[model samples]
Target: TQLLEQSPQFLSIQEGENLTVYCNSSSVFSSLQWYRQEPGEGPVLLVTVVTGGEVKKLKRLTFQFGDARKDSSLHITAAQPGDTGLYLCAGGGGGATNKLIFGTGTLLAVQP
Candidate 1:
């Protein structure tokens, strides 16, 4: 079974700070996705990367897929208080099932 692991399990920073979270796995995945979960809500999909070496940006957040498709990263620029949440990275097993393996997750807190 493939497992995704996230780094820096916890983070707390002031508003306007920059940070980067990483997701890595030994097995390669067909696609990778990033999500954010708040206190009382399910995770919200932030971005997805289907191709190796693909990079996608959403406003202040940037997502990148490694060249080998076995790793991914999320970088937040000038993070705001609203960005505080649990950051997750999921790998998709492309097929009929479309199964996904989620990483451990990163907890982020941005203080004002």
Candidate 2:
């Protein structure tokens, strides 16, 4: 049973605030991806970390993969109203079932 759990299913914050979202699992993954989705649209890939303890940064967003490949994290610095959206984490096993497994999902609202 491979499952991914995410904390803080919902978040509301003021502009310029910092926030972190977590993704955890009991099974190892070959790769992990972070995505941000808007209303009525597909999620946009934010980052993909393949190696354990790998870290990647995109502008104000930072992503980290767990050393065991069973967890990941996303940190946003100086969050703005424009950052309000749904954040999703997906894991890839890299086998015959290379399909991604998504977390429950997170909704973030950044008030101006």
Q: What's model 1's TM-score? A: 0.97
Candidate 1 stretches with Cα past 4 Å from truth are none
Per-residue lDDT of model 1, residues 4-69, tens digit only: 999999999999999999999999999999999998999999999999999999999999999999
Model 2 error, position 103 (Å): 0.6
Q: Name the lDDT of candidate 1.
A: 0.96
Candidate 2 has which clashing residue pairs, if any?
none
Q: What TM-score do all the candidates reach, one by one? A: 0.97, 0.97
Total backbone collisions, model 1: 0
